[model samples]
Target: MDTTACTILLVDDEAANLDLLELVLRPRGYGRLVRVADAREAVAAFEAAAPDLVLLDLHMPHRDGLAVLAELQARVPEGDFLPVLVLTADATPAARERALAAGAHDFVTKPFDRLEVLLRARNLLRTRLLHRAQRDARGAAELAAVQGRLLADEW
Candidate 1:
């Protein structure tokens, strides 16, 4: 899969954080990025963008990150590999636990290392792409079997 073609949804209340995330990803050939400052608009943006990955902020005004994560969980179909990387300054164990339980694929605390962020995002994207490929292959195989059965019955 071409990672550069993947769409990424950036969900952060702070403009600076959004800018920073764009800065980090733009140079890496990540072309399609959708930035959403309000948590309220996240689901809408997500639905519109259909992003392969989401970089989410834990603390927001209208809705907390965990709540947003829950909403996302409900929206995204089961078995779909849409990775959500929780980015927050709250490095507490409890926060990490909550995010993970809420369906975050990876957690990164704020003031995050640039290199680490890139690596983590890359890894998650890789997994997502692989999952999509496998699902597609499975679907193709199922379709082939159905077609084969139909031809056998016709004969």
Candidate 2:
């Protein structure tokens, strides 16, 4: 974990829970961390901080994790993918399904495992970066096709 370029935007309303997560991620080599206690501020914090990954807590006061996930999905462009890890003590199948449908890249059941958290975070970040790179390549190809079409018209 060369944590040099990684930042995690952690969204958890509970102070104690937030502290526990900080302990987990820090030792795992995630040095750049921004924590927002409210779900409402997650989007703004995400954009402002520009984190490479996010660890979202499922249960919150005003807006729940599912709601926040939906918002993030709405904001991301077609080619942009954000890695969202939903942390929940609840292990119900319905909860997992909803989180996945709302755009979370993975789920972390709480009473957290030190190793699994880091592994999932790293994997999801890789997925997001790859998706963005592929999108950039597609955009470049589209631009080249348009240029070729214009050149053909001139000829």
Candidate 3:
């Protein structure tokens, strides 16, 4: 998948954070960006956009990032992958472990390094695309095998 064409959902309560993220990502060729200030809107936005990646803030009103992550995890099929990168000011080891255990593919501390964020996002997107490609290939191979068996039986 082309990074430029990939849709990314940014879920943060702070407008400034959303703006900053958009500023950093747009220049890096991430054009399809969706921003939501309320964590409550996240699941709806995600369902509507079907984004290739998600940048989720750990703390938000109404529903926390962990709750949102759980919702997303339940929504996604078992075989499908949705890379959730959790962003938070909490730099504690416990916070990081919790986020990872809650289904976050990656975590970024507050005051994130612009370069690191971009690199991580890019890497996650690449992984998602690779997984999709592998699944498609396996599906095709299975279909081919079935067709071969049917042809042999007919002969």
Candidate 4:
């Protein structure tokens, strides 16, 4: 998938953080960006956007990142893959472990380095593209098999 065509959803309560991310990503050829200030809006935005990647902030009011992650996991179909990258100020080992266990594909600490964020986001998007291609191939193969069986029965 083209980086410029890929849609990314940014979930953070802080307007500044969301703005900063948009600033960095827009010039880097990421044209489709969705920003959500509240964690509660994350899932809705995700469903609406069908983003290729998600940048999630761990600390948010009403619903925390973990809760949002769970909702995202539930929303995604079993065979589909959605890459969720957790961004947080918490650098503790426990926090990292919890995020990973909760289905985060990657983690970035607060005050994130611009280059690192771009690189990680690129990698995750690449993975998403690959996953989608594989799923599509599997679906095509299944359809072909069913068609072949039908043709054999007719013969």
Give all TM-scores, in the order shown. 0.96, 0.84, 0.98, 0.95
- lDDT per residue for candidate 3 within 1-155, as digits (tens), equals 57778999999999999999999999989999999999999999999999999999998999999999999888998799999999899899999999999889999999999999999999999999999999999999999999999999999
lDDT of 1 at 115: 82
Candidate 3 stretches greater than 4 Å from native: none
Cα lDDT computed for each candidate against the true fold? 0.92, 0.84, 0.94, 0.93
Q: What tens digits encode model 1's per-residue C-alpha lDDT throughout 9-60?
A: 9999999999999899999999899999999999999999999999999999
Q: Determine the backbone clash count of candidate 3.
A: 0
Cα error of candidate 1 at position 29, Å = 0.5
What are the runs in model 1 whose C-alpha is more than 4 Å off?
Answer: none
The TM-score of candidate 4 is: 0.95
Highest TM-score against the true fold, candidate: 3
Candidate 4 runs further than 4 Å off: none
Report clashes for each candidate as comma-separated counts.
0, 0, 0, 0
> Best by lDDT, which number?
3
Report the lDDT of model 2 for residue 150. Answer: 100
